[model samples]
Target: MIEVKNIEKSFGGNKILKGISTVFETGKTNLIIGQSGSGKTVLLKSLLGIHTPESGTISFDGRIYSELNPDEKRELRTEIGMVFQGSALFDSMTVAENVGFPLRMFTKDNNKKIQERVDFVLKRVDLTEAHKKLPSEISGGMQKRVAIARAIVNNPKYLFCDEPNSGLDPNTAILIDNLIREITEEYNITTVINTHDMNSVMEIGEKILFLKDGLKAWEGNKEEIFRTDNEAVVAFVYSSNLFKKVREAYLKE
Candidate 1:
């Protein structure tokens, strides 16, 4: 689990995150959602230790991230996995190589051991037959799968995805969300996602944090979000034409 307590940050003189606090539970999907410049990005980065909070505390499991020394920070780094916005797979590397890259970089295992790890993760993500394929040779969804396999191959305690479904068709986006949810539950990893997709919100939002500007405006699960009386959240939720239509139907019922 990860916890952010009374977090604050500033860039130049502008405060990016202000007194933000939330708990991201393990073995569940934790979503941070907001519009552009709403500080969700800053909060995500801060939790990842990419941006140090000006005055606050971030703890991964039980380790206080704000106070870690260099070696300890490196140890913490190895415990977390990140899936970037894009697939971020190496175009030149085959799928097997990409998924096994972490083991190669971090472990001193022999070729057989490496191959075994690679094959295990490949099959885990259902990409067993595509091991020889390059990133360009696979579909976007497959590329995301390969990225996920790579992210988990090292057996991280934490998993972070930055817009894991961005730039995908709606159907493909949902498929990716389901895959992430399944993996998170199976591995019991502390998973956090940065997104603006409402479909994802309703689909895998075991824990949701609603950020407006910098502060956390609200927090709840998927069920409570729709009935929230907060004006900002309602506007954000029903602003989409699709959601607006659904809201109308539900009210008429």
Candidate 2:
């Protein structure tokens, strides 16, 4: 689990995160959702140690991030896995090589052991046959699967996905959402996702944090979104005609 306590961050005197506090539970999909300038990205980056908060604390499990030593912080980073917004796979590397990159960079494991782990993760993501293929040679969905395989190849305890379903057909997007949720549950990883995709929210949003203008406007689960009377959440989530209809149907039931 990850815990946040009254964290504040600013840039060039523009406060981006203002006293944000929340807990992201383990073995569930915790999502941060908001408009383009709502500060979700900054919050995500802070959690990843890319930005330093001026106040408050972020704790993983029981260890506080701000208190960790340099070596300890580096060790903690090794336990994290991140999937970038654009399916950030190396263009020149094959799927297997990309998946094994972490192991080679972080561990003294032999080539055979790394290969075995790479093969296992590739199979887990159902990309066994794509091991030798370059990113350009496969479909976008396949590339996403390869990214996921690489993210998990090191057996990370925390998984962070930034818009994992970006630039895909609706069907493929749903598949990727399901795949992430499944892996989160299967490994009991503390998974956090920063996304604007409402379909992802309805499908796998076990925990939802709604932000507006750098503040947490509301927090709840998928079903609670429909029942919520919070104007900020309602206006943001039901902005589209499709979701408005879906909310109406859900309330009727």
Candidate 3:
């Protein structure tokens, strides 16, 4: 589990995160949803240690991030896995090489061990046949799968996905969402995903944090989202007529 308390981040003149506090539980999907300028990306980056918060602390499991020494910080980074928004795979590397990159970079493991782990994760993501393919050679959805396989190849304890379903068809997007949720449960990893897709929310949102204007407007599960009277959440989530009908139908039942 990851615990964030009173996190605040700012640029020279503009503040991005404003004293946000939340706990992302292990073995479940925790989603951060907001508008484009609502500071979701900054919050995600802070959790990833890309940006240091001016106030408050971020703790992974039980260790405070600010207290970690240099070596310990490096080790903690190895335990954290990131799936970038753009399926950020190296175009030149084959799927096998990409999946094995973390092991090669972070561990002294031999070729046989690396290959074994790579094969295992590829099979886990249903990409065994694409081991020899390059990122450009595969479809977008396949590339996303490869990215996910790489993120988990090291058996990370914390998984952070930023728009994991970006640039894919709705069917493919749903498949990726289910895949991430399944991996989180199977590995018992603390999974945090930042997204703007409402379909993803209603589909796999075990815990949802709704942000508006750099503040947490509401926090709850999908069922609660439908039943809540919070105007911010209602306006943002049911902005479309289709979803309004869906929420109405859900509440009726």
Candidate 4:
């Protein structure tokens, strides 16, 4: 699990996160959602140790990020897996090579062991037959699968995805959401996602954090969203006619 306590961050005197506090539970999909300038991305980066918050603390399991030594911090990074917004696969490398990149960089395991692990993760993501294909030759969905395989190749304790469903059709987006949730449960990893996709919010949002103007305006689960009376949340979540109708039907039921 990850815990954030009153964490605040600023850039050039413009504060992006304002005393945000929340707990991201393990073995579940925790999502950070908000408007474009709401600071979700800044908060996500703070959790990853990429940004130094001026105050408060971020703890993973029991270790406080700010207190870790340099070497210890490096070790902590090895236990993290990140899936970028763009899939971020290398165009020149084959799918298997991309998946095995982390293992080669961080572990001293020989080529044979690396290959075995790569094969296992590829199969886990259902990309067994695409091992030899480069990112340029595969569909966008396939590239995402490859990115997921790479993220998990090291068996990280924490998984962070930045808009994992971005740039995909609705059908493909749902598939990716289900895949991420399944892997989170199967591995019991502390998974956190930064996303603006409402479909993803409803689909796998076991725990949801809603931010507005650099502050945490609300936090709850998928079901609670429909029941929430918070004006900002309602306005943002039901902005579209389709979701408004869905929420109406849910409340009616």
Per-candidate TM-score against the hidden true structure: 0.94, 0.97, 0.98, 0.98
lDDT of each: 0.90, 0.94, 0.93, 0.94
The digit string of per-residue lDDT tens for model 4 on 1-253 reads: 9999999999999999999999999999999999999999999999999999999999999999999999999999999999999999988899999999999999999999999999999999888899899899998888888999999999999999999989998898998899999999999999999999999999999999999999999999999999999999999999999999999999999
For model 1 the TM-score comes to 0.94
Off-target runs (Cα >4 Å) in candidate 1 are: 248-253
Q: Taking the tens digit of each residue's C-alpha lDDT, what string does model 1 give over 1-253?
A: 9988999999999998989989999999999998899998889889888988899899998899978899999989888888888889988899999988888988999889999999998888788899898899998888888998999999999999999999889998998899999999999999999999999998999999999989899999887786678898989988989887876676667
TM-score of candidate 4 versus the correct structure, residues matched by position? 0.98
Report, for all candidates in order, the number of backbone clashes: 0, 0, 0, 0
Tell me the spans in candidate 2 whose CA falls farther than 4 Å from its real position.
Answer: none
Residue-level lDDT tens digits of model 2 in 57-141: 9999999999999999999999999998988999989989999999999999999999999999998888889888899999998
Where model 4 places Cα greater than 4 Å from the true spot, the runs are none
* Candidate 2 residue-wise lDDT at 253: 93
> What 10-residue stretch in candidate 2 is worst by lDDT?
123-132
Q: How accurate is candidate 3 locally (lDDT)?
A: 0.93
- The 10-residue segment of model 3 with minimum total lDDT is 11-20
